[model samples]
Target chain A: GQQVMQIPQYQHVQEGEDFTTYCNSSTTLSNIQWYKQRPGGHPVFLIQLVKSGEVKKQKRLTFQFGEAKKNSSLHITATQTTDVGTYFCAGPVGAGSYQLTFGKGTKLSVIP
Target chain B: SAVISQKPSRDICQRGTSLTIQCQVDSQVTMMFWYRQQPGQSLTLIATANQGSEATYESGFVIDKFPISRPNLTFSTLTVSNMSPEDSSIYLCSVELAGRYEQYFGPGTRLTVT
Candidate 1:
């Protein structure tokens, strides 16, 4: 069995402040994916990191994968109210497996 | 990207009742998964519903309680049998398109058992 752990179960920040969530896995992953779930909406795919030590950015948000592919991080610069949601990091249950093992997720609240 | 639709967006059921949630994808897909998310909790993989064969359930989840049927490649149903208060949660279905690793989740069925 595989497990994914995320840090900072809940976080509150000023509108202009920054936020970061860390994710670690009990086993190495072939690829890691990030998802965002709003207050009442379903989980939406945000990004996916495949290469080790890869860094991808989407506007104010940045995603990085560890060199060992066992950990990852998501950083949001100058967070806004719309950035309030739960961010989950997931990885395949096993190599070549489509089933994903999701981390507990980090719930971010950006105060206006 | 696939367009996914789920039936009965939200429902309130009594104890010992069963609710069947339907998941339909616009296009044919090979992999479909059911997940349960409690209030302020993470998504838990319930089972993988692949067309043609029996579903593979995760640990602590049994078929008798959460039976699934993948009658076709684009449609599936999950029945929550003899549910109780603890079964109150949001049930979501996700599909993995061919050659795409990312999964697209449905709006989810919010269930509340009293």
Candidate 2:
């Protein structure tokens, strides 16, 4: 079975500070997806990285996939209060598999 | 992305009781999955429900405890049987649309067993 691990289980930052969460998978993944879950809401799809060494950005959030496709990272520049939530990184159980194995996730708290 | 709706947003159940959670997708999908999330924990895969075949349970999750039925492509049901205090958690159903790798999750059912 494949496993995904995340670093910095919990993080608290000043309103204008930056934050980053790293994810590593026990096995190489075909693709990796990121999700955000608010305090009382369901997990929402954020972004998906398919190509190795790919980098994508959405507003202040930047996502990067390692060249080996076995790890990934999410960096938020200048976090705000609205950025408080848990970010989870998930990857397919196997090549072409629909089932995803999610990392423990990094809970972020932005202090205003 | 898919729009999923789950029934009984929240419920309180007694020990030994069973509660069935329904998941309805806005469109027909081929792959649907059930997940459990405890307080401040990551999402754990419970099972995979594909239309027309038996559900596949993950390691640590048994079919008898979390029975799932995919009667059609747009709907599925998960029943938590013989519940206990540990059974209390948020159950969510997600769908992976055909040809897409990303999955969309439902709002989830918040269940608390006494």
Candidate 3:
């Protein structure tokens, strides 16, 4: 079975500050996907990293995958109030598998 | 990304009752999954529904308690049987379109057993 762990279960930062959440897996992954869930909404797809050591950016959010493909990270530069939500990292159960195992997720609270 | 929708956005039911949640995808998809999210907790994989076959349940979940059905590529249902207080949570269904690794989730059905 594959397992994904995330650090800093909860984070509260002032608006304009930076935030980062790290995710580690017990086994190497073929690809990793990131999702965001608002206070009372369903999880929304954010981004997906496939290549090892790949780095992708969307506006103020940056996603990186480890060279070994066993870990990933999401960094938000200058967080805004709208950034309040839980960020989750998920990976396929195995190579070419469709089922995904998601990390516990990091809940971010932005204070203005 | 696909447009996913779920029926009965939220509901309150009595203990021992059963509720079925329906998921519909605007476009055809290859893979669909059901997840449960308890209060203040992360999402847990309940099962993976494959078209024209019995769903594959994850550890600790069984077909009796949470039966799933995927009659076609765009529709699925998950029924919570013999609900209890612990059964109260948000149930969400996600789908992976062909040739895509990312999965998109529905709005989710919030169930509360009284």
Candidate 4:
């Protein structure tokens, strides 16, 4: 079984401030994915990191995959009110399972 | 990402009752999954809703308690049998689209068992 844990369970920051959440896994992963769940909404796919030490970006958000495939990270720059939500990182295990292990999440609240 | 819709967005059921949540996808998919999230908690895997076959349950979930039906590629249903207070949570259904390698989730059914 694989497990993912995210740091800063809860965080409050002023608008325009930067934030970072770290995810560590209990077992090696073949690929990792990130999701965002808005208040009272279902989870939405954000990005997927498959290679070792991979990095990708979408506007203000930056994602990094660890070389060891045991960890990942999400960083937001100049956060806006729209960025307030829970971010979950999921790791897909080996072949055939297609099961994803998700982190508890990092809850971010942007204070204007 | 595929579009997904879930039925009975929210409900309040008495103890010992049951709820059946339905999920419909706009496009045909290969993999459909079910998950549960308690109040302010992370998502937990329930089972992988297999089309034309019985679902595969997780460590804590079982078929008798949480029976799932996936008759086709784009439709599925999860029935929470003999509900209890502890069963109150948000149940979600997701689909992993073919060739995309991305999973999209349904809005989810919020169940409250009293």
Question: TM-score of predicted model 1?
Answer: 0.98
DockQ of 2: 0.92
lDDT of 2 at A55: 100
Q: Relative to the true structure, how large is the alpha-carbon lDDT of every model?
A: 0.96, 0.96, 0.95, 0.90
Q: Rank candidates by DockQ, best first.
A: 1, 2, 3, 4
Residue pairs clashing in model 1 are none
| Per-model TM-score versus the true fold | 0.98, 0.98, 0.98, 0.97
For candidate 3 chain A, which ten residues in a row score worst on lDDT? A93-102
Compose the digit string of candidate 2's lDDT tens values, residues B1-38: 88999998999999999999999999999999999999
* lDDT score of residue B2 within candidate 2: 86
lDDT of 4 by residue, B54-85 (tens): 88898999899999999999999999999999
Give me the overall lDDT of model 4.
Answer: 0.90
Q: For model 2, report the TM-score of its A chain.
A: 0.99
Regarding DockQ, does 1 or 4 come out ahead? 1
Q: True contacts preserved, each candidate?
A: 0.97, 0.90, 0.81, 0.84
Candidate 2 per-residue lDDT, tens place, A32-65, comes to: 9999999989999999999999999999999999
* Candidate 1 regions with alpha-carbon error over 4 angstroms: none
lDDT of 1: 0.96
In Å, residue B77's CA in model 1 sits off its true spot by: 0.4
Q: After superposition, how far is residue B74 of candidate 2 from its true place, in Å?
A: 0.8
In Å, residue B67's CA in model 3 sits off its true spot by 1.0
- Angstrom error at residue A97, model 3: 1.2
